[model samples]
Target: MSSPAHAIYSSTLSLSLQGHAFHPQYGVQLIFNEIAESLILCGAICSQNPSCRTFDYDSSSHRCRLFEADLTNGAIIAAASQTSIVGSVILSASLYASMYNQSCSACQENRYQTCSSTTNTCQCPGNSYWNGSMCPLQLFENAACSQIDACRSDLNLSCIINSYGGFTQCLIGINLFTIFVYENTKIVQIETMSDYASLRSNDGVVSPNYNFLFDENILE
Candidate 1:
């Protein structure tokens, strides 16, 4: 009969070991119905593969966990031993590290513009305006104003007008009593008043019974 193979013992899990090996590491032990054979196979696998850092075998389910590198001590160990084999695999580094390239530049050039590394946006020229992902329109300078004017239309107030300005001005009498300048030229003024009463009263100077009385509340 052949002698049983002795398990290889090491202070830490072997980085090259995978699957079943000839023996478990120093702190590690195989708990399987066929512990001797399982340990031998795992040790052999780990020795052959450089990427295989560590491995675990479940006796119950006959499953194996191959790790690219050893994690923390308790992290790779199973919480409970069961009849089924259950295992977990760990890569050499975090999975995301492998997915993204850290050395790549931040900005990329497109057809319309060159993207900025700091702002992560396309750079548009001074005369160009950005439209969505591309620069579409060029900007131009605006014309200056030409001339302005001022005038008066009604009783006690003055009116001012603008030549090249966008708006017009006019004076308006409130309640036929006080004269106030209204900037917009849309309203029309009809008759004049001596005082606020003549302005607010129903009878104007054209009426025979016109009585001009200055009401103090009008000033208030």
Candidate 2:
């Protein structure tokens, strides 16, 4: 293989798996593939592409494959050949600014909405929820929630009052079941779905003071 031209290794890349390679599975997609004489050449090619998030370099074949894959997007299976290395780009680095050279649609100049490294669109900075047209401020998925919109809008989670009695509206003749809530104002424990039909068989009073909260993660 011919040696690759001397190019400065950009500080925006990080090695994920050394001496390891991955092949596309059934539904995997790739940005492009090319003959790369060295690992540096493979990474340089990935840096040149805006959508290239990962790259795999095969030492024996002198080939490189660029992909939009990432740890959160999905996992790639390892190949039988162990003479390769895999690297991923840092989304939060200055490289992102250069990657998104083109202007994003509907992105206001001074709205604090930056370009999303994953979606390549204009969205709220630091994982804020984007509501298509604009980024609406929202709480984290694992944080203490109070209102129905407490969690990220993308998650589409239901708001259940923790430490409350039970969901009176959840029960209907034979089609519905009672959902019991906890009584702790500051719910620090995980709440499970408890269905009791006998307790409130008929019309029951709904508690006015439904406070405390529990996310879908802690619910079973």
Candidate 3:
């Protein structure tokens, strides 16, 4: 079967940036007596069952394995086989509260997180934030981040493109890193402080290390 174009996530958060998302070296040892045609189908089947936290789908044999472990410490990402698909259950807000009743009884998460018997939700108790795998002390400024939801909202942070355009980081507001007004031939030298330093704590003005002569149109 073909994978679905979109998804409705779930509460089974097997996310761990520190390492593989979940499963021990022995792996998520329990295989559900279930089979799925695709990875998405395995997740869909997990969504229907409240006790499921993560699933591994083997495309070669169509095996849908499930897990219910204390995720205080997160796991790394790897496949039992090249054809295996692994994932956690990160549900959406709309369907979130519905998963309050039933979930895994085992709490393998780190000290910062706790499993609420009544709500069936594992949560970080204080200022610490959950970074997919385990709860960290705090979210720092300029930290590498992939999603806006992963950043600390109380600090009014957003994930934006970085200077090199290679990765994203948590910066204040929707601030664009830098802008170069490319002129066709005019080489207007900017004898000014560094452009990006404005957002830094020491105020806007920082010394430039070196200057580059513009030669965008010049041929070899």
Candidate 4:
């Protein structure tokens, strides 16, 4: 009878290897070896494993390193041709177990809402009434000014008088009552109600009792 023929196991770098297992998600592979067969086997293992991000193979030891996360490629390995053939299969069941556990946990609540990580928090916009991330309850309440008239300067009431050559006064409807004149002060006290009414009404009539002479030559 002929000697039993040796079964040659084909190696591949693709993720479709038979009987290969890996994380369920988010995995890749990095290859570091120059050997064609080793590269092929590493790729095949990673292809079969869903969560294997990459694979690293040391040619010096014919060792295959598998990672469940991202890996750096193009790592140089010397004396790769002299290394002995080691076992083909190496498995780590707890690969990336800690990462999965941490990602699944909930973060603490942020009071200011400014936490930008996976945690949900409340943050305030710029120029808002509140100083911090959260808006205050009494922000912008009972403001001193309104949108229509901020300073309350538009009173709309004015006064005109016949004295001092038809002088006009701006009557600002505020708490104070005052008057101003451009000329020198000339006192003419009104003792009767008729004199006061004539000055107040601005009817263009000068009272005879309060008459004062002015020099005509002063105009020139």
Candidate 1: where are CA atoms >4 Å away? 1-37, 72-74, 82-220
The prediction achieving the highest TM-score against the true structure is 2
lDDT of every model, 2 decimals: 0.30, 0.46, 0.43, 0.29
lDDT of 2 by residue, 100-130 (tens): 2234544333223455454445434432332
- Whichever of 1 and 2 has more TM-score, that candidate is 2
- Candidate 4 lDDT over residue span 1-220, tens digit each: 1121210121223332332323212212222333435745655554444334445544454456555332122222232344432212222322222221122221122111122233122222111112112222111212232111112122322222233423234233322222221224555444332233234224222333344332222110
Point to the candidate with the largest lDDT: 2
Ranking by TM-score: 2, 3, 1, 4
lDDT string, candidate 1, 194-219, tens digits: 23222222221123233222222422
Worst lDDT run of 10 residues, candidate 2, spans: 194-203
TM-score of each: 0.21, 0.40, 0.32, 0.19
Clash number by candidate, in order: 23, 3, 20, 20
Model 4: lDDT equals 0.29
> What would the C-alpha RMSD of candidate 2 be, to one decimal place?
14.6
Between candidates 2 and 4, name the one with more favorable lDDT.
2
